[model samples]
Target: MSKLFRAVIMGPPGSGKGTISERIAQSFGLKHLSSGDFVRENIAAKTEAGVQAKTYIKKGLLVPDLVMTRLLLPRLEEMTKYSWLLDGFPRTLAQAEALNSACDLDVAINLNIPLETLKERLRHRWIHPPSGRVYNMCFNPPRIQGIDDITGEPLIQQEDDRPEALVARLRHYKDVAKPVIDFYKAKGILYTFSDTETDQIWPNISTLLSTKIPTIQSDARCASTH
Candidate 1:
């Protein structure tokens, strides 16, 4: 079979795109390539593109499309040798067109969560700084009050999680990201999952993965794995 299972997960911040993508990647044997994480990794390695990106990043400015494209293209090319799921890139129409020209995505999964629900969910959000483990006091709180369940460290709220900042970010996301979503929709490759809750959403996602990637479902431990 051709090693060409490429997917992109898109949603506003705090919409559970990351969590859902992680679950899908692990369950389906797809490499999870998060663009934000990838850029950070590159910066850590001090690669040429990373060095270019850091100049903007350190200045608290977004990396230009050309530079980000340079940084991401190689990673996407490498993943074409195997199955992979991409997250957090193509935030603009130009970037989406560029990425499609380079490596056409097979699927674009959109996590559609209501703004009110997201605002409420993020209100209770806390995190472990070192491990980046997130806790939501509303639904998925840690076992210990204001502490990480795995470690006894106190949780901290992210600056971006603040109500005002989140609202601005989501507005920007909706404005800038709609074109990317429409591009995929026109191609008939976009899928939306209403992310009200993980439990309600996972069954549909699991079933889709099973039907789309049968090799993953054949695992005897697949049922227990989730």
Candidate 2:
């Protein structure tokens, strides 16, 4: 049997993590897991942990470490049979340690985007909340200004994407991510990609994965693996 390939992608907000992650998932045939989406699903379903997490979110507080580990670890445990890519979990040293204790990771991709680029991209970002479709006005405007193309509904900028909140979010991410990056670097699995655009960085990432994961059913319809 081939080894299970597990990896994590880390980046600041507006770093195009979602875009790159989607590409990586498709190109590698790995199940993409986003912690934010997982938490939202749990909260939407009113699971026990989700209910508890809701209380913290409503207060604009960080979800406690124990709660986070408890919430994510089980979901990871369930994914043991599949190679997967993780996004947006283990933000702090404690969380990283918690994750390390459970399983080894094959790679930790860190997107090093300039702060000015992040600010500009996020400032113009708008979303169709109901559909979660995001568009950057500068690069990908909708058919009608301030309107959703398909539904004709208004598109709104996320609160966190607004200028005032964005700086704080970016700073917090940097502060929390350093230790985690250092930890992975020490393990010699961390790969840092610096670029102003995801497209420029994607080729290297693709090359890296081609060497990391063995030949399997990457593009095959069957679920069997080598």
Give the Cα-based TM-score of candidate 2 against the true structure: 0.86
For every candidate in turn, the CA RMSD to the true structure comes to 5.8, 3.9
Off by over 4 Å in 1: 46-62, 127-133, 138-156, 215-226
Clashing pairs in 2: none
* lDDT string, candidate 1, 1-226, tens digits: 3335778888888887767877888788788787877777778889988899989877645678888888898878776678888888887888898899988677788889999888887888898765656778877789988999898989998777788988888888899899999999999989889957877887887887666665433442455555
lDDT of each: 0.80, 0.86
Report the C-alpha lDDT of model 2 over 7-91, residue by residue, as the tens digit.
Answer: 9999998888777888999998899888877777778889988999889977756688888888999999999999999888878
Query: Candidate 1 local accuracy as lDDT?
Result: 0.80
Of candidate 2, the 10-residue stretch with the lowest lDDT total is: 217-226
Residue 193 lDDT, candidate 1, scale 0-100: 91
What C-alpha lDDT does candidate 2 achieve relative to the native structure? 0.86
Candidate 2: Cα lDDT at 167: 85
